[model samples]
Target: MEASSEQPQSVSVHLARLVIFSAVVLGLIVGTLEVTLEYKKLRTTLFEHSEQVAKAFEDIAARAAANRDRSLAEEVATGLLEFKSIASVEVSDETGTVLAWKECGQVEAFGSWLPFEIPSAQHTILLELSTPSSGGEAKGYLKVTASSAQATQIWASQLGMVLISVLFGTALLAGTLLFITHLYVSRPMLRLAEAFRRLDVSDPKNSPLPDPEMFRFREFREIAENGVRLMRDIKRNSEVRDLTANELYRSQKRLQDFAEISSDWFWESDRDGGITYISPSFTKTLNKKTGEVYGRTIAQTTAEPVNTPKWHKLGEIQRQRRQFRDFRYDMAIQPGEVKTVSINGRPFYDEDGTFIGYRGTGADVTNERLIAEARNEALQRAEQASRAKSEFLATMSHEFRTPLNAIIGFSSLLSMPELLKAGVDRVTEYSTAINDSGQHMLALVNDILDISAIEAGKRVLTLEEVEIDGLLSHSLSQIESQAGAKSISLIVEQNAQVGTMVSDERSVRQILLNLLSNAVKFTPSGGEIRVTVDEIGKDIVFRVADNGIGIPSDRLPTIAEPFSHSAIHPHVAKEGTGLGLSIVRSLAVLLDGGFTIESEVGTGTTVTVRLPKNGSGASGEVQTA
Candidate 1:
């Protein structure tokens, strides 16, 4: 069987052992001192007794010595030996002759039987014999040797009794002290310890301590009171600590939720600006894992070069430990795909004010960037439209007033009696001038209405099979007189293989007429115009060429837009409503065809129109000029 481990001694047991040991040590010291003092007293008493015996026998011994009386000396020595302290005695004469000797054999034997040895005491006495008249004369010497055997034996008996008494007293005192300490100190302290052991710090109010009054000693009572106060303080501090921890946990959870749910990603970096943490939203925003981004600096993630102004500014801000916001940059998240990112960050420091690094939120702002660009573009378009409207109003005013002025002047002339009676030819000329101005005004109004209808999506097409040659010939014939007025040459090239095509007859004819008219208007006198019609693939292609003051290259992009002429040459813009090409373009689009124009300053222009053979149902491709 395994031996039980040694149990620890309680305070009471330890105190009892200490008291017993102290009492035993003190008893031993007192006993030894008493025994030693008794021994010395016994020796002194024996010496004193020997001196008395010597004095009493002095006269007798001297007389014996002078007379040489052996019986007398023997009597003195034997008498001295009668005393228990005197173990042996000898009487000697002046001549050195021993007169008598006596010794106690029993005393010697007794000393030898004793547990310890005691040395015999020795004394010498002088003997004198003399008359009263004559001074006493020395007669003999008396030698006395005393044995301490009896005294030592007596001392031993007393010592044994004294030690017994001391032992009994020491044991009794130790027992009494042990009881007192256990009751007054040890037991009370043990109770206090047990109370502490059972105490619940978590609920200090309900966990009572041993009452201070339970301890008999003032010091112990005070200790109990202090323990109560300490536990109370501990409970209060613990409650506060728990509350703070709970609040901190909730705050952290809220921040975590915000980071998880937000569209933006949160990031943290070390002091060297290397990425330490990136939230899960980083993957959602950049289409890359957070792990891949870790250990990389912000500059490494950007498409821009590290030495770019944006990075330089960011570096400067970080170096100065400042906050920055709305810092936008481009990041190539994937091959050939760059996203715009905006970040707001601030430098963080530890409690000791050592720079930690940066923490911030970043959002993929590519969509926002695109939207902003589109908004700016729309604003520019609106401004251009407003300017064009003003120009159109100005051009229209001039065009209208010119015709109105002619009509008013001619009508006023007709109203005058001198003009009315002038002649039929004059009247006819005035009337024709008014008619021509009205017709010009009517044509301008028609162009305006047609353009408005097209823009409003109200224009419709009536598709049919059409003769390409007939259409071209009719279109060229309408502009022939205008070309003749300028003495310009009009050339037509028609492919016989381009016999017919299915399309909106009116739109096709109108498209060709507008092209021819624009050519005539732009061509100088004696310049040439060429018209070509051919079938290309599944479409009928029409080309109108002019050797005239061609359109400016810068204005070509918007040349087919209505009222765009003001941006071109002012002289050419004023001569017409600037809706001819616009109408042609709109009609071509409505019929699912394409129109393109190529022009150069002083080098002339070429305008091409592609009409699908199958009309609005067929796809027509537009070639860029």
Candidate 2:
């Protein structure tokens, strides 16, 4: 059908020949019609002219008839023949006998009556009239003939010239019109259509229309514009369809590779609040299959089964779909024989923020949740035990310290000048022993108090604005003595541009102390530790690097687990509690901060802790060696 729809199977020839042929044909038709009309008009006019002449002749004949004189009739007929248009006049009696006529011999049958019919000629007339008679019998007819062979020749010559003139005029008109129409209308239209017919209609990106600048007609320009618009629309539609198909294919491929990924049942809706699409993942999650819920509502599909809080969780989102916000439902699901899922609803959206649909992942968090619950219970029991244990330890430590204080006071008295004279050596031994024992007992009490507070979760943080230089200087001071014991050198560098980090001053000091001590303990004699303070965005970042034994990569994720110790860190002294790093991690979370470590097996480990700067949102950067 399209093969024939285009400009196909056309015969062409020279312009001259085509115009000549068309002109000849048009000329024949127009000329014939014009000649026919002219003939009819002339014939009708000639008939009217002949009738007037006959009436004049009849008036004369009637006067003669009233006079009842044949000589008068002859004279009147002759007088009536004045018009050259009238060829001759004949007067006849009632019996069809010629009464009087002028030049009766010039016409045939002048005295005899023939059937009085109009004559045909280029210019010829036939007419008759009868006088009204008083008697019932009609007196006679006054027959008038208006014809001249010469006049017929004259009219014929005029008609012949008219026919020739019409032929020439019609030929010129037809030829000129055909040429002008071809130039202005037909030729331009043909060019425009021929260009369109050559377009590649199969490909979406194909250019289908010639440039509209080539079109001279406004109509053709408009046509070309419309074609370009249509092409653009088709191209866009094709792209969208292709993208949708590709997305579906990729999603299916991922599904197959993963071999039964966990399913989540979410009541899906679109920006218009209509259920435009749904997923089969729900059926698999619920230990069911497809077919019962493919085209049904959420109420019909879910295990909730009715107008409980679950079904209505998505109702508001459906109503406000135009706003493009997601509906959140923190609900639980129990797939029979499958693991229980603690689900959180998360919906997806387009760049316009229009709700596309809901898709979220679910994990079996049963073990993690149960462990956390047990930890909470254990923590409560430990707090109750710590109060009793701490009280007894404090009582014992105080009781022991009181006697030691008395011994120290009396021993100091012995060191006075008079007592020193009597027993100086004994006083020195008492002073030294008393001082060491009291300090030892106080240390045991403080350790118990610290552990007790940690278990009870009653430890408070004193957040302060510590400038960068002061913070680094103070932390270095606290750890300089520890590092010096191992013959380790400590270096500190601070950035002047680092604004104050809004952190618990004591806690920050403790975290830094723990990291520095670990570095000092692990480093062989003469090893080095470096502490650096810097500004990242609006946060203060602290990094501590040590050329000490590094942790295994496999233990990185679990290093922050409570009471868990990395094998690398155990190479140092083993007497310390394993809760230092865990305490640091928990405190960091409380302040919305983070800690990280990077290590190589034998080279070194670098730890970075990022804390929020004053008045900045809690975020920063840190890197470890």
Candidate 3:
């Protein structure tokens, strides 16, 4: 089990409590001893001083009696007032009368025991040695008073001494604590932290701390030493374990990223049919694309503690597929097409051989599936085209054969006299028919060759600077001659500001010829076909507009699609191979230009082309036939 961070806090709490409790107890014990000793010493000194004062008063009284002067006792009491501990004294007469005193001079006292009730060495004595002289028998007594003022002085002195001692002791302890903390805790902790920082994650092996036990304090040294050893051992173990773990993580991530971009979704499911890991490629495959459908399994979000039967399937799947890594399967993909998946499932197990889950990836095989499905469709299209070409060739062969057979038979007949006489008109008609059919067949063969070559990417664009006015005029001239035969007007209205531009010269001429031819053929006798040019910012725009029977709106957009044409235009005119506009669009794109067509039913149609203004070098002009 991992240790708790609060474990150290509990130890520290106990240690701190012990330290604080010890300091308090020691302070109390030392303070009590100091105060007690001081009280005893001061009290003893005070009692001795009090005894000396009592003896001095007694001598003063005797001397005063000998001199036969009671007033002399007041003088002696005054003299004793000079002592520092003396509070005050009273000198009194023998009849309990007041005698002379320093504080209360010549006071009267009869018989009072207040004089001897004073503190001694640790006891209080009430009275002793206090009678006046009457010639061996006492008739009158002399009185004395002793002050307890010594007790006050001793208490003051003792309190002051204790204050000084405690202050000095506290200062010394604070300095010691500061030095110990810095030496043991602060500097050593800093060194240990710095050493730990030098360790790298790549090798978490036994890393020793620098100056691990450098703390001079014994406790700090021991802690530092033990902590370093423990950390080093853990680091060594962690390094060994993380090595394989990191490699596995990186490999899984790379595989997942690769699978995400490919055609098919990769999926892994347990034996009881719960998804474990679904690759992001789940949404798209070679044949079709889908959206996010993450409802794979209950464990998709969290790998749970297995308790139920469904969860137990992890073990079952691992037991079955332990030997095989992957297998293929097909799944239903809706809306676009059914997808084929090459799914590979492998069992992942814990150290104890209990299955954790299954992990695998899949690839969509839709393209492979469609190709397999559409084989006959492709075959039919190829076969039909082949048969059409064969039929065309055979028809032409028969057409040519009849002409040849006729011509041969006729020529042979001419060799005889009657056929020779019948030859001129009949032979001329047959010869013309043969020549026309042969020429038509030749044109078809050439068109077929051109289409084939174009489809096969044999054609290359020959770009050069084309003068807008000159190109339009040449194209219009050819169209005008053809339109004149049909009594239609073909006109060129080129604005001079339409500057030169780089383009495929032959392609441009072909585009213009195709547009103009279509216009003239569609226009009626009174209709006009106009070629115009306009400058449009960085590009030059060219338009061929016709006042002819116009195209319907619906068919206008399809004008540029290959193999598309409207039935409305030029019924008697020759039908195009439908590759013209597609070729035009392709050429326009090749020149980095664009084409657009607009028309309204019963109105004229306008076809426009735009090319950028950066003209090709004049020296690179393409010679177009």
Winner by TM-score: 1
Candidate 3, 1-625: lDDT as tens digits: 9777673444334544555456556765787587767767766676577557657566556556445455776676676666544545555444444455455333233213233332323322222223455454322223334443455445445555665566566556645654665466656666666776775645555454646446666766676777677667767668656876898889988877777666555665564447655665565443333332343443332223456564466446555656343333345455544445555566666798766666666665557667976987778656655654564455546645655675566566556667556658866765676566566456445444544555566666666677777787788887777798878876677666676776666767877877887788667787887778888777777788887777777656656654444432454234444445656665565556888887765678888877666633212223332
Residue range 480-574, candidate 2, lDDT tens digits: 78778888888877776775666667667767776786677667778889888888876677898989877678767766554454323446434
Quantify all predictions' global Cα lDDT against the true fold.
0.82, 0.61, 0.59
The digit string of per-residue lDDT tens for model 1 on 321-344 reads: 899999998988778989999988
Q: Model 2 segments beyond 4 Å from truth?
A: 1-88, 91-172, 204-267, 270-286, 290-339, 346-625
| Candidate 1, residue 279: how far the Cα is off, in Å | 4.0
Model 3 scores worst on lDDT over the 10 consecutive residues at 120-129
- What TM-score, computed on C-alpha atoms, does each candidate reach? 0.62, 0.35, 0.38
**How good is model 2 by TM-score?**
0.35
Task: Write down the lDDT that model 3 would get.
Answer: 0.59
Candidate 1 worst ten-residue window by lDDT: 616-625
The clash number for model 1 is 0
